[model samples]
Target: MTARLANKRSFPHPPHAPPADSPALSIFSPIIQVFSRELQRQPDFDLLLAELCLDHVWTEPSKRDSKGEVANKMFLSHNVLSQDFANFFIGSLGQLRSIRVVHTVSNITTSGTMFTLSCRDAAPIRDGDLTVVLGLDNSISFYSGHVKCAVAVIAR
Candidate 1:
């Protein structure tokens, strides 16, 4: 059976031109790194394309097949995606803390966790500011070949 990425993006030609690490692609570093690592687990699995928006990491694999081999691979990628999204949007305690302190491994709710992506660091965040919120879907499974990381951030 033919396989596809989570978002099922249109697969272009086979002329592979995977990106090399550069400053421009820094925000997507987390997904790229995670996807690259998974590529190693499957010798035939090459990363044809990758795009990280909000919380989901969409990719066009060099080849697609049943999700029999990369079960553990998706687990690792999803784990990193959640952490990076949280850190980039929610920030640390002093950055954007709530009255209640809750410690959990992942902030993935069924409705998708809210966090921020992209850069908003030229000026320091003041007490009152409105930022575009994004959400990442936590209950997704890339191994199932249906990864959906949908996500946001709005705070003082």
Candidate 2:
């Protein structure tokens, strides 16, 4: 079977380019390092675990058989992701206290959770303050205030 493009977008091939004087190599690198250390010590850290959960997906659409019925299979390894989306998620992990994902897939349920995370940073443009909507078909879920409270409690 051949794949069809339902839509398309035209953006810079590489969304972000590393500069000659990148922050990673700048004098402020120490400050950034302290900030990351502080973030890790704040609460139930485990950045690695959070990262895995943030990227994990239970079921993905397997290749269709001759009959064209999409076969559902457990995602064995990592999912193929877009650079833009990956950057958004990584940035969110640093800014937000916690992110929660809940996926419910059963025989009779086909509806997923819908939620948004609106960032109101100092400069919307440079900080990339935007609303992200995720999860479509009983797959991904996000809860903001609840996650904050949970993280707060864990930190305490």
The TM-score of predicted model 2 comes to 0.19
**Superposed model 1: Cα runs more than 4 Å off:** 1-23, 46-156
Tens-place lDDT per residue, model 2, 106-125, is 22222333222433211112
TM-score of 1: 0.16
lDDT of 1 by residue, 1-156 (tens): 346563345544333633455465677888988988888888886456544223662232436424322211111111322321122222221121111112345543222443223232211112112222222321211110112233233343
lDDT of candidates 1 onward, in order: 0.31, 0.30
**Model 2 alpha-carbon drift over 4 Å, by segment:** 1-17, 20-37, 50-64, 71-156
